[model samples]
Target chain A: MVLKVGILGGANIANKISRAINSIPDVAQVVVVGSREASKAAAFIERNKLVHASPVAGYDAVLDFPGVEAVYIPLPTALHVEWVQKAASKGLHIVLEKPIAIEDEHVDAIVKAAADANVVLFDGTMWMHHPRTAAMEAALQEIGPVWDVDSAFTFKGSADFLENNVRVKADGDPLGALGDVGWYCVRAILWAYDFTPPTHVAAHHGALFNEAGVPLNIAATLLFPGGRKARFLAAFDTVFTSKLEVYGDRGSLRLRDFVIPTAEHEASFVVATANGLADGDTRIATVEETRTVRNAVTQEAALWQRFAREIEVVRAGGRAPEYWPRIAALTERVLSAVLASARQGCALLPFEHRA
Target chain B: MVLKVGILGGANIANKISRAINSIPDVAQVVVVGSREASKAAAFIERNKLVHASPVAGYDAVLDFPGVEAVYIPLPTALHVEWVQKAASKGLHIVLEKPIAIEDEHVDAIVKAAADANVVLFDGTMWMHHPRTAAMEAALQEIGPVWDVDSAFTFKGSADFLENNVRVKADGDPLGALGDVGWYCVRAILWAYDFTPPTHVAAHHGALFNEAGVPLNIAATLLFPGGRKARFLAAFDTVFTSKLEVYGDRGSLRLRDFVIPTAEHEASFVVATANGLADGDTRIATVEETRTVRNAVTQEAALWQRFAREIEVVRAGGRAPEYWPRIAALTERVLSAVLASARQGCALLPFEHRA
Candidate 1:
């Protein structure tokens, strides 16, 4: 059976999802596109040449479509809580783009509603579905117990994404850099490091020049229960770069240019190990192989296909994995820490968990 | 009046002092050069082609050099405490290389002897001599009360400086990274943030390869009194990279390529601040300047020349600044935390000052 989806906002993410849904094998169909203005939704369909769609105004019309079984939310951050709750009430499975909500209460409501409705709910964190994530993780494990995890994602800017656009809003402000890129780094650590919840979270965030820079760059450190620690940095106004290195006892695993992967190949962390104590006995550690994929485009396509597989799991009368709620909770937890640190101008310790 | 000096080792630092002492107008002769091996000392003298008398064989020869009122200790990590104490007993003022000792006892003895001798003792942390340090600090002050300071120093291994070489033997051992590059990054935070001594210490360290492999890297966070925090990453088995960034309420100040600076001149940090809601103007608060030095080598030369200036203060018979002991004490304190974390693989809270 096909899962017919209605996109609730005509945003860039909607375009990406339309492409993804079109590519996935008989899993999802984008039947309707809705915006506050009918012309806007119609324009999106016309521009993308989306053949199968009902151009509608307001979210209710999208929900009223008989074939729409799931809702793909690409609305402003502030609208997530309301729409996700509404979609759940209408018995629609949901895919909410990160951050899910700007405030904790909004996230709380959405999480509780999804739990009560017993429906599939996932945050559109694309990298989690990337094939290379598993390969890089397995390679890291070969090195043994991880001692440190560090990540960085930096870029000069996205001028094209700006220019009086959708994220440029009053109360519907775009999430800060931490909310955007930092979330990915946080997820990368979560996935690699046994999905441990951070015991202590400390963060530093700052604005940039363009697009009402919402904490465009942030640096945060998460301390786990064991002496294990992870540090991450995300930025919009820095030179283009992203890397993840997991330093372990026996060796280390590194993914250079992680967030913005290169085409046709992958990079590995150069390893070094001791051979023996005798003079001239030492040797450079072996370089293990990592799963090489194409660019971010292919990685994204691979993940969306996997997510489409999970749609079958959702259809089988069970439930989507709790990974989505857990990720939602963690993102909120980290974002809260960043805000507290920003307001206080000092490290916030014993970070408050979402009750 | 000249402040006569004698050298006890032929390390690279000793070469730097030769140049500084030769160039300074207030300096005297390079009276003596001593090493455990006579040929090695002679080779150093021949390489520099100095006017000093023949290179001496025993440690005592330099201790007994005529008119030598001060000593520069640029020897191996383990040997620092012994020489500092011996030099102190002989009433010789000293400029000690960093990691004053690989072990706490070594630092304790050096601190005690310096106090007992009523003579000047300085750690050769020459990066402090860079004018930009003061500039960065001044900018930090303007930003508001600081909450976090992040620092890193990493570089590819120098084949010539492999583990077990006398200079790095102790530091290249299982937990060596804690005392080697780790000390500098730790000190940068302690000094930059002026954080109080920690009450507890925890660390996580492991072989970049295995136990027998050299400890090539360390990542640790220190918690100070009153909720202040500092985090750092230091390594000898990665790319040559260094950075120092301080986060405050109003904005942040960052210095890129810190350990080994770049010729582009000024190190930069983008200070981000949010405009009022009405203005909707958020941008980097600009404060740009050029470093003006060629590279790390030239920058290092400038640092030693500044070290010579401190000799002027010593010549005046004044006590060294209060910040010195605090900086030294914090280094040992944080290193202890790093070691503890490495041993236990958990975040150690509130590092304690060693007894």
Candidate 2:
């Protein structure tokens, strides 16, 4: 009774998730691969050596395939709304890749369709499922209420990538760098704030866009109630890094490899505790040390395993934990707010997701 | 040949620098300590064990004291311009504590008067003189053009301190947490940007103020030309921490104890390097390692030593380097812009200082 999963499109991310799914052989398997062109999908399966999966032409074929309980949609940002609705209609659960939808309205619609079909809908945010995330949360409890977060995820793409990559093309992934790298930054801040809505969203007034008007670089600040604030920076043309610092009333946690660990075996973060002012109130007395959390499998595999369990629950006629879709929808809501702020000349706007 | 220095006010920071100055008997000594009340100045000198210094009843007495070649003014923010001017008229070099003035306009005037008197005017920014700063600058070179910076300096103050501390009073330091702690945050960003003025400044909406309207918490963004930017967070009611990160085109640098080291004998920072994309572009390849920079004395002593050297040149009839004053003026210009943005309903404003 392996949870059969289908891969849609020959996206670069497909190879990684496919391998992750295959690793959890007893729980889930990549049962099929789908693409508009069958040859491209076949080439992708061959490249990743997905022996348990077969290739089919057209994305619809995967939705219609027998035993395909879930479809991992790695399609471009613009394609999620259509394919996800179709996949949900076919009663298949979803493992939609990040920037799940380009628009916030589309996010609610997509999630609602899945709920109507009684299928689990989960965004492919791998880090959220990692055991280290739980560890970081446990550490955060020592720090009291988190009031500040600073995060950055930037990658130095090839010159050709900035010029021609689908990520930077308005028609392909309209959110561009904001949709690509910034997705993690936004989620990290929201996670630190425990999913509470920010009162104001403002961009840093230094966003860069491609010729197609896709964002290449963006920086934004979110101000939550109770004087809590978060700032995030994302870029496609800058140095590669994933950094997060969460400061609370009593302590702080810093993770340099937050988005993706330097290695898959373990992840580490620094926790700093201070006794406050000392030495004539000129030097702050602080004690900082690193703590590591190790996982038996990679974070991506953990994500698949968790999603597979939810599918198992649904197959057994039990509930599929509704928080998954709720998190996805909330992340999309905040993501839209940041995009709106960036598009509106970096104006400060209220983060209102209710329609 | 020792540089005889006069201390203005019994401000908390004065104790630190007086100890710093008294440590180097060959280069400098605290010749006089001044306060509106003589007992307070005498107590400060006794507490800091400034054996060579005597107490004076008024600030003007120190400026007029025989053989006092320089004045270290750690008075409240509102008193700097008046005392600095009076001291300059007496041909005294000056080491003024940070948040040099309540307004940017006063910054130009203070520097202009110092230049006119041919006196060395160095701000009491201890970290600028630390050897770790030089090492950090050298490490930043590997990162290429720094495009982004994030820094924070915050302390969780007691209830009494927040209510009664002069820093929270409009007449004492109008800048409050911003002036007291954010001065370093602003200077750290400007230093990362090579003292270049930002084109725009905007503060986060989460700023908190005391009864006197002095900011207790503030967060801001400074946008330079070419889309380079920096974000700073300062607070009086948070877990104590001083963190800095500079991201450039090729790599990044992170310093946890950037404002004040955990230990005076040594300081450390992390430098991360990335090879851009890896694992089918799903994971970014990065390597981060920590580097330590040790100093023989605390940064405060180093600051006083550097300022004493400048005073030595002035006393020797050689021209003092003018860049120190320039950096101080530039930092004040940016600091005022952040406060203005915070006050103007957190509006985004141009960072203009030319008047």
Candidate 3:
């Protein structure tokens, strides 16, 4: 009953997923590692200690592997659309890395291909699968209608990373920070609003660009209907910060580590319910409640487990879940709008769904 | 000799300042309470237990009180210019409440009057005098050039407040939340950047306006030269939160209560120095250090003490300090630009110094 998974590249992120898959034996296991060079794939498997997985010379071999029910694509951003469509054509489900593609059209193409093949597709935003996320969602619901969300994910890149990382290269990542860290912020915001898209997006000025013209640091605000708004800051040029705060009419939720919890097994978020100010006091007092959740597996493993569960449902002749690809598409659309806004002098760009 | 201070209009905030003045008997003392009705002023004095201060029938009577050496003006927003001018003409040093005036021209007139009378002038942003502010500033320097500053100040308003508070009235505190809570966020941002004005400012959409068109909640971004930036969120419709985060190349500073210390005597901030992530890690490892400062006096008392020191210097024939008024003007200018940007469909407005 275990789902056999294939990894499509030797990217560093693949190491983490390989380890995650190795930890969850009953749900799923990575059985194949694919790369242009078999030796590189073997090295990746060895370094990550994936003893059960075998290395293959090319991605196509992984797609064609008889036992591979799903493929985890950690390929560079430029290679996503082609490989995802090919995987779909081969009837394999997908666990795609975030910033699923450089642009929305590519995402549309991949999504359409997945639909055509009736395959389960999910983006690898691991935090979305964490139990803490569910707890936060329940807390937000208790807080009343959310009116504001602020999130940030930033980390300082080393000199070598700035110079040679695929993220800073125009053809490699193209979207750079917006596609990498920004993906998490955007997804978290959307999740806070139950996958509803904002009506308009505006980039804040002072976006930093790499030599290849990809954004290295950026910030933007998303305005939804009914005065609901969200803002996010994503950067590869600042010290590490991963925080999200959601404000509701009656309360608020704040988490210091939203993208990745400080501990693998435990996560916490603070909820504050408004108590209004005491008589003649300048500040309003609130009861701050901290909620903590413990998980038996890492968030990445949970993500893999969820993907496997969906794949099993599809294998049983059930329809592929539409919600996964829908959110992925929405995340891509908002990111593209932010980039467009940044390029056009931080203008407010109306959100339009192309797919 | 202690500076003899006069209170104007009997605003609720004046009670805090009156207590601050009473606490520092060797430095300054409240001598008079002024209001349209002598009985109301007397009631305010009795309620606040200011036994040494006498109540005056009118604000001008407090200004003309022979022993009044200074004035603390907490009148409604629309009356700031007139009272400040009269206080200056009486050759009294002045401690004015924030949102010093509604517009740049009004601030210009106040600054001119203070200069013409050669009196010390300061805005009543009490946190500016806290020892923690100095400690945080020193830590920011160690963190290197600040490239980003984020601050927020918000408090929930009661039904009575939303309906009857002067802040929501068109003719009372017309600037509303921006003038009240937002002024603190803007001041903190400018202070973090050493009062260097940003090059441009833009308001985010979703600014909530009252029936009289006063902002109840707002967010904005300020872009400085060299890719440095600041952002602020101010609201009267959310749970209370006052946070400031400053990011630099090497480190960052985070304060949960930047506008007001949670405790009167002790305040703390966290500083994180980037150590670079371990190889193959997703986030940079940081050394988090928390710094705490203990103050013998409340921030309000510290503010009054600082004002007294400045008045002492001016009384000794030194010129009034220009830095105080200069920063006040800059904060107002940026606030005005944010309002302008918010009105113009969130357009990026170029920063200009009208003073």
Candidate 4:
């Protein structure tokens, strides 16, 4: 009953997923590892200690493998549309990395192909599957209505990474920091609003670009209906930071580590009650409460578990989950809008979904 | 010798300043209280336990009172220019409440009047005097070049406050939340950048306005020259949150209570080192350090002591302090640009300082 997962690239993230799959032996297993070079794929498997996975000569060989029921694509962003479309044509379930496509049309095509093939699809945003995320979702409901959200994800890239990494190349990953680090910030904001897309998007000025014209640092604001707003920043030149703040009418939720928890087994977020001046006093008094959630499995492993469950449901003659593709599409739409707005001199752009 | 001070307007904030003045009895003393109604001024003196102060019928009376060398003006936003000009003409040192004026022209008039009379002018943003703020400034230098700053200051208004508070009225406090709460966020951003104003400012969409066409909630982004940026949120309809995050190339600094510390005597901020995967490991390791500052005096009392010292220097034939008014004018210029951008449909406005 194990779901056979195939990896399409020898990317660093592929090694992480390979480990995650091996950790959850009851539900899923990595059956094939593919790369442009057979030697590279072999080395990746040997280095990761992926004893059960068989290294293949080319990406197409994994797609054409007889025992592969699903594929995990950690290839460069520019290659996502072609591989995802091909995987969908072969009726393979997909665990795609973020920044799913460089453009919305490609995302639409991949989504339509998956729908046509009746296959399960999920993005590789592992934090969404954590039990702590569920706890945070419940806490938000208790706090009255949320009105504002601020999130950021940043990291300092090494000199070699800036000079040689495919992520900084225009043709390799056109969105650059907007696609790598910014993808998480966009997804986090959308999740906080229950997958509601923004009505308006505006890129802030002062976005830094590389020699080839790909952004290295950027920020944007998303405006939703009813005075709800979110602001996010993404950078490849800053020290590592992952934080999110959700402000409600009656309370607030703040977490210093939202994209990736500081600890694997335990995570915590702070909730503050409405602030006010105490009776006959000028100083404000706000009561803060900390909430924690613990899980033995890593968030990445949990993500694979959920994907395996969805695959099982589809195999048993059930419909593919609509929520997964829906959210993925929304994330791409907002990101595309941000890029367009930034290109047009930081103008306010209307957010429209093709689907 | 004690510097004799006068209180102009019976505003609620005046009560807080009166207490701060009394706490520093060795340097400054309140000699007169002024209001539109003589009876109201007398009642305020008794209610606030200002036993050493005399009540005056009119604001002009406080300015004319003999031996009054300084004045603290806590009048409504619309009345700042008139009282500040009169007090300055009397050669009085002034402690002005924030949101100095509704328009740039008004702020210019006050600055000119103060300069003409050779008076030491200081704004009543008390948190700037906290010892922790100095410590934070030092930490920023250690962290390397700061490129991005995010700050917020929000508080929930009571029902009576929403309906009857002068802050919500167009003719009384006009600037509304942007002038009241947003003033702090703007100042913090400027301070973090060492008083260098942004080259461009843009108001984020989704600003909530009251019935009187004044903002109740608003957010904006400021872009400095070298890809350095700042974003801030100010709201009157949400729980109080005074947070600041500063990101640099080598590290980051974050604090939950930036506008007002959680306690009068102690404050803390967290610093995170640059993250990286440990040698031969896949997990990111970021070290977080907490820093605390303890003080014997409240920030407000410390602010008063500094203002009193500056007055003493001016009284001894020293030149008036230019740094105070210079920073004040820069804060107002950024605030005014935010309002202008919001009014013009979130347009990107150039930040121009008259001073």
Candidate 5:
């Protein structure tokens, strides 16, 4: 059965998700495209050659659409939690394009709504499902235990975006650039380290400015438990660059262009052995399995399908409802601390996230 | 008359200083080289074709030389304070290389000795004296009011150094690899922001590994006051890379290679302006300034000579002897807090240097 998907905004991310849905096999079908501006929604539908497009005059209209099983939210950062909570209250599954909310309180409401309704709610973190990320994680396992990780994702963007975009203006905090990009980086480190979130967290926050004298770049460091740590550099006013390194006890894994890349497939591994602790020494390793990966968007759609299966099983009383709330709460907790550290200009120690 | 410079050890930095002294005009003369191992000092003297070379036991004889006016102490990190104090008490001018001393207590005694003896004490912070650094700072005036600055310097060595070197040997408390290269980065940021050290400091520390899975790699962050901050990364078991970036309101100046570059010269800067903010178009006005710096070591030596002159003038009633004592005390206080923050895994609040 095809799971019908509706887009609630005419933004770039929604358009990309819509395109990806069409490519997925028996998964998501783009049913309706809605926007506050009817002409914008019509143009987006016409551009994508979709059949249904409507003005988002009210939330009830999108929720009651025939065959609309899930809503893919691509609103501004400020509206994520409000829309997610509303959709889940109406028994609609949600694929939220993060950071989940402008504040942690909204994430709490969304978590409660999803828990009470027993509905599927997944944050849109497509990179988590990317093939390279999985490969990087598998490579970490080969190295035994991960000891440290370093990451950076920076790009040169306009000063206007830094000072006046949905980030600082709508969210009331300019450090969302770190949240938007650094979240993927932090999660990648956690995933590599077996989903262990930082027990103690510390960070230094600062911004880069453009010719117009506006803050357009930001960077931070996150300390995790058991001595595992991560460093992130997110910029909208510098050169374009992205890279990640995971250093383990036995070896290390390096990923260049961690977030986005357009070059030849380039990756490396360093192993520490009896001889001089491996210093970028190359070695031939055997590949035991051969597999192909779908495009990023298609893979994300597939993960959404997995979310649907989990939701269905739970609704049928085959799975416990407690699990989803924990993950949701954890996500909100981590994201909240990241922003708080940036605001406070110091590390915010992690607190217990009670569901 | 040429200023006779006697190097007390045949260390790596000593060799660099000898070469730099050769390039500068009417400043430094490599008159004598001495070491406990006579052969080591002889080899350095012969390799550099210096005028005199002797064993460490003949320190008094070398100091008695008519031309020996200044002593350049490039001993181990632990010996910085002792040698500087000894040289100052002997009525000889001193050029002390960083970090000055690993411990805060050592700084007070050393600074006092130099003051009482009426001798100049110059910390060999050459990168700040490099022409590109001057250009970067001068460009800051063009960029407008500075908001935030980020700096980094990272390199790789063997795991043995992590355990054996004074840098990571934990003076009283366990000091990670951060105390070595990390100090330079922290000092650079503090100096860039006019020595207003952060009231709060926090850090995330990590390790590479030893045979027994001990820490051999570390990275950390420091929060400074007025929204100024820094992050530093260093390892004894990875690759080598260094970068320093100063982001301002109107633009940013960056030095990709802060130190130890293979090329003859390294460093560059970029200035970007928002077009819309400038009253017209909806595009950014961006400009980049790129240039290669020359003779970083010699530039530092020149700065040292100027500092000597200033110290002489300041001693002639321009400034009180108490002025520099406060500066030295404040620097040590900052270093102590950084060490505490790294060890405790929490923000170390700043305090007045009582001693």
Candidate 6:
């Protein structure tokens, strides 16, 4: 019942999934690694210790590999639309990396391709598969209804990376920081709101763009129905910071490493509930409790195991869980609105259009 | 020499300063309690056990009280213009409770009157006086130049408080949540940004208002020079949550009880610096250290001691600290821009006027 997976790129992130799949050979195994150059793919396989995987010359070669049941597409965001559709047409289940596409239409096209092909299409947001995410969400019920959310993910890119990295190339990442780290910030907020889209989105007035017009840093505020609000920021010019906080009427929940847990096996979130009122109205005490979740597998491995399950369902002629692609589409559409708002001096963009 | 202070209102906050001054008997003393009704003043004196203080029939009488060298004005926002000008004219050094005035012109006027009278004007933001505040700010240097800030102060108001309280009364505390709790959120961001006004400001699309057209909840984003950004939220319709986080290029510092210290004698902040890189491209570890500051007296008492010291300086024929009034004016100007942006459907408001 092992799913044979072909990896379509030799990107650095591919090393993560390769290790994950190899670690959980019973659930999934990497059978082929593909890069524009065969030598790079061979190097990747060796570096990640993928013994069961072989190198292939091109992306299509990986897709055409015999017995390739599913393909993990870690290609640049700009290439997702074409490759994802091609893989879907090839009848291979797909694990699309984050920011499935730069344009909204492309996201719709990828989702439609998967739906038409009846294959699993999961966006590779590793943190979503973490057990601690669910545990934190469960604690939300006790905090009353969520009224506010704030999240940020920022890492200072070395100057060389900024100059030579595909992420800063307009023809590649295009969405830049927004598509890279901002993807997680957006996804986390959506998850907090139970996948509900905000009513309106507006970027901060100071979104920075690289020389190639790729966003370097961007921040936005979203207003949902009932006055609920969320703000997210992502940048490539700050020290590493990943945090997500969802505040309800009675309390709040926070995690320092939300996009990626600081530790591989153990993750925790703090629940802050109000307590003792200081004698003066100066300040009141907050009762904080840290809840921890320990998982035997890395979140990436967990993601692969779950995607493999989806592949298993599809292989058995059953429908895969369609929620993942839909989540990706919703996330992309909101990101589109944010980027659009940023492009236009932070104009307000409504999710739904009405006269 | 003790500074004799007159209390201008019998509001709940009066109990705090009364106790603070009573505790530090040498620096300051509450000489008179004033209210519209002499009986309420008497009741306030009795409730606070102000043995050395006498009740006065009216605010003017307190201003005229013999030996009264200073005044604590915790009047609602709407009344500040008249009383602050009156107190300054009477040559009484003033501790003006926050949101000094609803209008920018009034804030300027209050500052002008204080300057003309050569009397000290201090905004009653107690947390500013905490030693931990200085400790936290000093820690910011190691974090590198702050590029982002996020702060919030929210408390769920009881139904009765919303319905019957001055905070929700348009003619009384017109700014409502913004003036009351939002003052802290705005001040914290300003503090993080080194008292520099943002280049532009924009509010979130949604701002809730009570029946009297008083804002009950608001959130806004501020964009500073060099692409640095800040966002703040304040609400009277949510559970108590006061947080301030200043993020720089290298690290960040956060306080759970920024608006008011959780403990009267101690406050702490967490400084998180990046550490161990996770094996995968997953999240790296963060090194967090909590530094605590323990004070011999409450922050409110510290506020009184400092203000009383200013009184001492003036009594010795020296000039008072001009930085404080300037800080209050700058905070008010930034707040004015934020509120203006909120009123105009989150329009971008610049701090300075230009072509």
lDDT of each: 0.63, 0.85, 0.87, 0.86, 0.59, 0.87
* Tens-digit lDDT string for candidate 6 (A1-355): 8899999988888988888888898998899999999999999999989888889999999999999999999898989999999999999999999889998889889999999999899998999999998898899888878888888888888999888898889988988899889999999998989888789998887788988899888988888888888889888876677889998878888887887887778999999887535656766866889999998898999998888877777777898777998898988888889999998878888886211
Please report how far candidate 1 places residue B156 from its true position, in Å.
3.1
lDDT of 4 by residue, B218-305 (tens): 8899988887888998888878888788887778888877777777778889887665544233345678789999977878888888
Please give the DockQ score of every candidate, comma-separated. Answer: 0.06, 0.58, 0.47, 0.52, 0.09, 0.60
Number of the predicted model whose DockQ against the real structure is largest: 6
TM-score of each: 0.61, 0.97, 0.97, 0.97, 0.70, 0.97
Candidate 1: regions farther than 4 A off: A1-61, A66-70, A74-95, A99-149, A152-182, A187-230, A233-355, B23-29, B52-54, B158-163, B171-175, B205-214, B264-309, B320-322, B347-349
Interface RMSD of each: 11.9, 2.6, 2.9, 2.7, 9.7, 2.3
Q: What shift in Å separates residue B249 of candidate 6 from its native position after superposition?
A: 2.8
Task: Supply candidate 4's per-residue lDDT for A134.
Answer: 95
Query: For residues A156-265, what per-residue lDDT tens digits would candidate 2 score against the true structure?
Result: 78899888898999889988888788889989998998888788888876788887888898888888887788888888977777789898888899886888877778
lDDT of 5 by residue, B140-254 (tens): 7765555455555544465676556545553421334444565567666766666665656554534343444323555545555555555666555543445566655666565
Q: Which stretches of candidate 6 lie over 4 Å from their true place?
A: A275-277, A353-355, B275-277, B353-355
How would the docking of model 6 be graded? medium
Task: Return the lDDT, model 1, position A117.
Answer: 83
For model 5, residues A118-194, the per-residue Cα lDDT tens digits are 67777777655555556666767776677666666555455676556655453333335555666566666666667
The order of the candidates by lDDT, greatest first, is 3, 6, 4, 2, 1, 5
Residue A168 lDDT (model 6): 87
Q: What lDDT does candidate 6 reach at residue A258?
A: 85
Tens digit per residue, CA lDDT, model 1, A1-355: 7668898978876776777677653666778988999999999887766678778998889988877888889788888898988998987888888877887778888988887887778788766666566666676667667656778655444565444444434355456566666777877777667777777766532223234545655666677666566778766544334557666656566664455444323423343332111211111123344445434344445555565666677678777667777677777666766656544543546766653
RMSD in Å for all candidates: 9.6, 1.8, 1.8, 1.8, 7.9, 2.1
Q: Write the per-residue lDDT of candidate 4 for residues A244-264, one digit (tens) a residue.
A: 888877788988777777776
Q: Which prediction has more favorable DockQ, 1 or 5?
A: 5
True contacts kept of each: 0.00, 0.58, 0.31, 0.44, 0.07, 0.65
